[model samples]
Structure formats: C-alpha cells, structure tokens
Target: MIVISDLRIAILGLGYVGLPLGLALSRHFRVFGYDSNPIRLRELRQNVDSTSETSSYTLEHSKITFLEDIKDAQDCNVFIVTVPTPIDSNNIPDLSALCAACRDIGSVLSSGDIVVFESTVYPGVTENICGPELESSSGLQCGSGFFLGYSPERINPGDRSHTVETVCKVVAGQTKGVTELLERIYGTALSAGVHVAPNIRTAEAAKVIENAQRDVNIAFINEVAMIFKNMDIDTGDVLAAARTKWNFLDFEPGLVGGHCIGVDPYYLAFGAQQAGHEPDVILAGRRINDAVASFVVDQIANMLRPSSRILVLGLTFKENVSDLRNSKVAELVTLLTQKGFQVSIHDPRAARLQAKAFYGIDLAEDLDESYSFDAVIGAVGHKEYRALDSSKLLRMVKNDGVIADLKGIWRAYDFPPPIRYWRL
Candidate 1:
C-alpha cells in the first residue's frame, strides 16, 4: 500500500539464506537484518560470518543494520522471514520456527504493512497457518489490514554460481497489487528475473516440488548405483557412457544430504498423505537416500576386518561448504564408530566446535601423518581433498588398504596395485 520508493525492508533469521539476501537487498533499500541468536549477531557485528555464505568484504561493506531484538525492525514496512523449516523425528513438517517468526513480526505489525516468507514449507502454510498467527498477534485482519506474500527462497548454500543476483525469484501474493509490489521490490537485487505465480498455494507447491524432484532423480541414480555395485560394475564409468546422450539427466549417485534436497520431499509427502493420497514415489526416494549411510558402512565394514583404522575425508553434507546440518558423512562416521571401528575424520572447511556440539564428534586438529589407516573414505568432494594426487592418497593407506571414494572423486586415476580402490 506504500510507495516502492519508500521501501523499508527487514530480513528475519540471518543465517545462510538471510545473510546473503539481506546484503543483496541492502543494495537497493534500507535493509534491517534481525536474528534471535546472540552469537550470530555478535559475529555479524564483528563482520564475521560463521555460515561462510557471505564474504568478510561483503559483510563489512554492506549498509544493512543487523539487529538482535525483533522490535528494532518496527520502523520497516516490509518484513521477509527466511527462517529454517526443518522436519521432526517422524519426518513431519515442523513449523515451529516459521510460527515463531510470524509471532515476532506480528508484534511490530502496523496497518498497511506487508510480510513475505522465503522459508520452504508445504502449500497453504502462509494462508492457513502464518496468516492467522499474524492476525491473532497483531489484532488485525490479514487482507484488510496487512498483506501476505510468499517468495520461497532458492538459496543453494555454498553455491557461488547461482547467487541472489543470478537466480530467478518466484513471488506470489494475495492480490495482483501485492504481487506487482513484490516484483518491483525483489527485482532490485535480481538481474535474472522474477516469476509471478498464479496464487500463493501454487507458488508454495512449485517451491516444494523443486527440491522433491531433485531428491527423486538422485534416488533413482542411487538405486541404479546400488544395482551396478552388486554386479561389480563402476557406476561412474556407467554414468560416463550413459551421459553421452543429450536427453540423459545429469544426476549423480551419492549420499543425498543437505538441508533442501534431503528434507523437502518429506514436506511434500506429508501433504499428500494428509489429503488421502499415497505418496509412494516420494517416500521411496526418501527411503533410499536415508538408507545410503548404513549401506555404505556395510560395504566398507565387509571389506575390512574388525577394528580397522578408517579415515573419512570431508564431513560436511556437500563440497566446499562448512555447514554440518544434516551431514550424511557424520552419520556414516557414527554408524562405523558404533561397530567398534576406529574412525577419524578430516575436513578443513568444517567448524570444529560446531561439529562437536552438533554431532558429538571432535574433529582431529590435524591428520595423523605418522599413522596410516586401513581404509580412507572420500566422503565429500572438497577441493583440498579433490586436488590431492594419487601418490598422496596411497600414502594414507597401508599396503592393500582400501580407498573408498563415495563421491567418485578419484575414479579416473588408478592407485597402486597394492591399494584396493573402490568408488561408489
């Protein structure tokens, strides 16, 4: 309802998604970044980003105001909530973070203000759940007093290629005016473009299925990889040959972990089951991806004898990212360690204190150069580990030791005959 020239944008939950977005939005508007975590605020005050999503140069140079209390954003007319929407132990959508964010925003809401969400969630969440909470806390009607919008975040953490400036933003609102207002507001930081969806629920469905489709594709590849493994064939080699066709999808087989691809499908599946439909394919993909950790451990455990000294390279969910949230490497390490094997992990990018706090696994300060392992697993494809030569990999293992490459990073180079090379 306000002029676009007078835009006052407030970003909530300054984590991986919020930090980069806040910085980008600050380029066009007077941006206020708020977070409940004191440590995150302290780090940002010092121009330090623990998530590694934003550079020190970007943080130090940005004109955004980082705040600890929610009331500091009271002056802003537009609030963008970019909090996490994780699943519960039973894999149901946990809206605790999203609900809490709505309450925080509602407390400072005024008439004619607008609130948009960038957190990933099931369809109808914005209208059914968050809008009512905002109305309750603000003592105002949603459409009459304040407006609601949904612009699901497409932030691929640690990805420098498809950044906030490059990726296309999908925005939907309760009305055409709200949608057009969002298009102009978010379009300031985006050069790629903006897509105006038909409605809020359609936009929400589009976002959830993007990651869910990726999970299913990777699950197919993983299932094929398992089939080829039983046949004693190299999945990397098979993929290399199969990818010659132009129509072949470029999905690789590996442990599907991370915040988005690993978890978003369950959000979709839950919605399906609640509507009296069986989400057979969606749940199947989830089951296969979930079982990969234990399946990998079984192969390695069967290869080596009891009490084998195993070393896992890289601990984060993906390559070049320091994020340890929902890391399958940590899961594999726990499964291996529970079987009485001496498992040591080395990841140069991961935070040691956070890793211990999150997973109860203390990262070694440095790799044991004096000692070698019975097996070394390349869990993640970090550049440091990926750039290592074959000879260096050979040295980390004893004679006839195993080198399990989960990422298939070293599938091309052949190790010495004494080294038992295996790749998934």
Candidate 2:
C-alpha cells in the first residue's frame, strides 16, 4: 500500500464541487485542479470563481495549483473526477462529459494509481462504464494496472451551512487499500468525517438517490399545492398548520431546477429500466416537478391582464448562487413571452453574460433601487430580494399589481396596501 501522505492528487472538473474539495484537500496533499473550460480556469487563476462557491480569499491563498492542460496531471497518483452529469433533451443521462474526463485522465494513468469519481451517476456507472473507458484509453488492466473509486459529491450551491468541509463524505474503492487511502485523505481535510461504502457502486447509488428522494418529496408537496389551489385554499396556510406536529417533513412546493434534483432522478430511473424493473414513482415525481414552472406561469397569467408587463426578480435556480443552468425561471420567462406577456428578468447572483449565452435572457439591469411594473414576481428567494421592505416591494409593483412569491419568503410580511400576494 502506498503511503497516504506521499499521494499526489489531480482533481478533474473544477466547478462547484471539485474546486472546494480541491481547496480543502490541498491542505493535506499536493493538489492539482484541472478543468477543460479555459475561461473558468482564467477566472480561477484571478481568484474569481463565477460559481460563487469559493471566495477570492480562499482561491488566492489555497496552495492548490489550477491547470488547463490535461498533460499537467501525468505525475499525480490519485485522480478525482467531479464533472457534471447532465440529462439530454430527451431527459436521458448524458455521460459524454464523464466519459471524456475518463479518456483524458486515462492518458495520464500510471500503475497503482486510482481514479475516483465524485460526479453523481447511477450505480455500476463507475465500475462498468468508466472503468472500461479508462482501461481502453490507457491500455491498462483494471484493478491491476490502475484502480477505481467512488466519492459522490454532496455540494449544494448557495448553501452556506453544509459546505464541502462540513458535510459527511461517502467513499468506496475497488480494494481495501484504496478505500483506506481515500478515508485518510478526505477524513483529514473534512471535519464532518467520512463513511466507507461497501463498494463503489453502492456509493454511486447513494449519491444518485439522495437527490432523487428529495425530488420525490418535493413533487408530493407540489402536487398537493396544485390540489389545494383548486379547493380555494393556500398551500402555505395548510403547511403552517401541518408543520405544527413533529416528524412532519418540511419540503416546500416550488420549481425543482438546478443540476442535481432535476437531473439525477432520470439517471436512477434509467438504471431501474435497464434492470427490467419499472420505476413508476420516480418518473411520476419528475413529471410533477418538471410541470411546476408551467403551473406557476398559468397561475400568474390567470391573475394578470393579457400582455401585462411582469418584472421577475431572481433568475438563478436557487438563492445566492450564480448558476443559471437548468433554471426553471428561464422556462417561466419563455412561457410568459409565448403567451404575449412582456417579461423582464433580474437576478443579483447570476452571471449576465452566461445568462444571455445560455438562454438569450437579457436580464434587467439594476432594478433594485428603482423599478416599477404591472406585476412583480419573486422568482428566486435571494437575500437581497428577501430583505426588501414592504414599502420597497410596493414600489416595485403598481397599486393593483400581483406579487407572485415562489418560495413564500414574503408570506409573513404584510404589504402596504392594494398589493396582492400569492404563493404555493
């Protein structure tokens, strides 16, 4: 067995997950962070993470070296792959990014080296899909020439409480030596400790279902939200009463966006189908969650006049993150635009250039100080929008304008007058 302290680590895909983990691990090893995106690399080099997961102070001070070229990781003995696992247009799991990472990493693989995947994928993907790709690309024997491991990333963008260092790490490896190596490596860096899964596939399954389970729970709340609406009752009021009892799950009803919750369920369902088992409940949750944006739009349209101008606050998938990928707000904007309603969107945390590039959304600039519209929708519950006084919120909308509170952040506040509020 190789000495844990003697290991050289190369982290592939320096996004929301890998970057933080790399920074944390750098304190204990010779960490080399690599990403295919040169633009992201340039930003990281300047200590500016567009992802907002890392601070400039940490980025500048961390001893970890960031790299753009794949050849730079040749000397590293441990490779951690934390790339995104996205779903295609048909909602099928796309492994192009993960496969490409394996091919690149395989080119640099050496004997006794272990490639650990942190990306969220269905069970057997790391062992069956990635292991073969690595062997084929590197011309090496699996578990003989180089080994494999799985450590599913548990990163929640915009979440300050359960950070990479604070959350528990689940890791599994092909061999006992490899598993112990990971336990010591991650356990040394993180205060939350690490769990050794029985095997690599078990770790993968654990990560995939973590997000899928949340998706199912949220779907139930959303379905009931729609049901309560038909009964002329507010879901928030019902939830407030229901939450009085202990053990009541506190999942809110809202648009399920972002990479993990929206995309991971399909991976699980796909794996289930491959095993010849029908995954009806998983698919049902996805269907309900996916329909949330359209349902929100329909409710908004019903309350407003045709061709009414609506100013949407917060465009990111969640509060306090710059990521706009798979954001349901863009879908809401598109649906409203198609319905002949003029929609102007704004998000304090989202990258403007990326938003325009990704969704062609010309985000309304600097609407915080002064802006007025026929209606104002709190699409994302960002802190800035959350802290807005009731008078300020009144100023954002017309006297008879409706306030669509998606996350119910403002449900407790009493607006000045004539400003109606609605939330799921």
Report the number of the highest-lDDT candidate.
2
Candidate 2 matches the true fold with a TM-score of 0.98
Q: What does candidate 1's lDDT look like per residue over 103-126, in tens digits?
A: 999999999899999999888899
Clashes of each: 0, 0
TM-score of each: 0.98, 0.98
Worst 10 residues of 2 by lDDT: 363-372
Q: Give the total clashing residue pairs for model 2.
A: 0
- Candidate 2 residues 240-298, lDDT tens each? 99999999999999989999999999999999999899899999999999999999999
Per-residue error (Å), model 1, residue 183: 0.4
